[model samples]
Target: MNCYECVQQGRSEVAVAVCYVCGAAVCVDHVRAESKLLRGPASPGKVIRDWPARQLTCPVCRAAEESP
Candidate 1:
């Protein structure tokens, strides 16, 4: 699987986002805002970091945390 956020394909543009939980790059689809307003009820906004760690994250992992 490929990163869903920025261009993280095989050393192309450099992985813009990397999943904190999985330690993988996240492209547009994988990366998401951590704010409730921006992400809605599904996903909340996380603290924006300076690097990929803050940008990418595993949706499955995040969803597990969201579950009650």
Candidate 2:
């Protein structure tokens, strides 16, 4: 599929990733990599300190999540 961000700029590049939050198709250039600490189904503090984590995000979601 075409990239959501590239389409906005009148370009059409192949989508390399999908935004986890918005499900928007994005190309490598539009993709934002982030580290997300995940919690397991086990009791709160019982989970591993560095369990499965991190994911790709889109520009829009990244901006909304950025610190002020």
Candidate 3:
């Protein structure tokens, strides 16, 4: 699919990822990625490490998330 924001600005760009918040297809220029730390479940003698998770968002949704 094509980038929604790019289409709004009259540009044709391929979408790289979908926004997790609003489910909008976004290009690299319009996509925002936030890193999330994952915690594992409690277990006996289990070696757990911090896993990095990524959350994709569009410019509009990112702005909303940043707002108080």
Candidate 4:
């Protein structure tokens, strides 16, 4: 897909990441890196485990939105 921001800027650029919140495709220069928590299944008596994970988001969505 094409970069949304680049389209606005009157240029056609290849997308490197898609926004997790809005699903807008964006180029590397328009993407922001964010971390998400991943949960692992555990027994009821045991504590749930979580690990940091990565998600790519567009600049606009990254500013005012969250992934579900």
- Name the top TM-score candidate: 3
* Runs in model 4 lying further than 4 Å from the true structure: 65-68
Candidate 3 deviant stretches above 4 angstroms: 42-50
lDDT of 2 at 63: 91
Candidate 4: global Cα-lDDT? 0.90
Error of 3 at 16 (Å): 0.2
Tens-digit per-residue lDDT, 1-68, candidate 2 = 99999999999899999999999999999998877787656676684455767699999999988958
* Model 1 score (lDDT): 0.53
**Pairs of residues at least 3 apart in sequence or in different chains that clash in candidate 2:** none
Candidate 1 residue lDDT tens string, 1-68: 45543333343333446666777666555565463323323336655433222333567667876799
Q: Tens digits of per-residue lDDT for model 3 on 1-68?
A: 99999999999999999999899999999998899998887688998877899999999999999999
Q: What TM-score does prediction 2 earn? A: 0.80
Q: Tell me how far the alpha carbon of residue 67 in candidate 1 is from the true structure, in angstroms, after superposition.
A: 1.1
lDDT-superior candidate, 3 or 4: 3
For residues 1-68, write the lDDT of model 4, one tens digit per residue. 89999999999999998888899999989999978899999998999999999988888877677545
Residue pairs in steric clash, candidate 4? none
Q: In candidate 3, residue 25 scores what lDDT?
A: 99
Candidate 1 global TM-score: 0.42
Candidate 2 local Cα displacement, residue 57, angstroms = 0.9
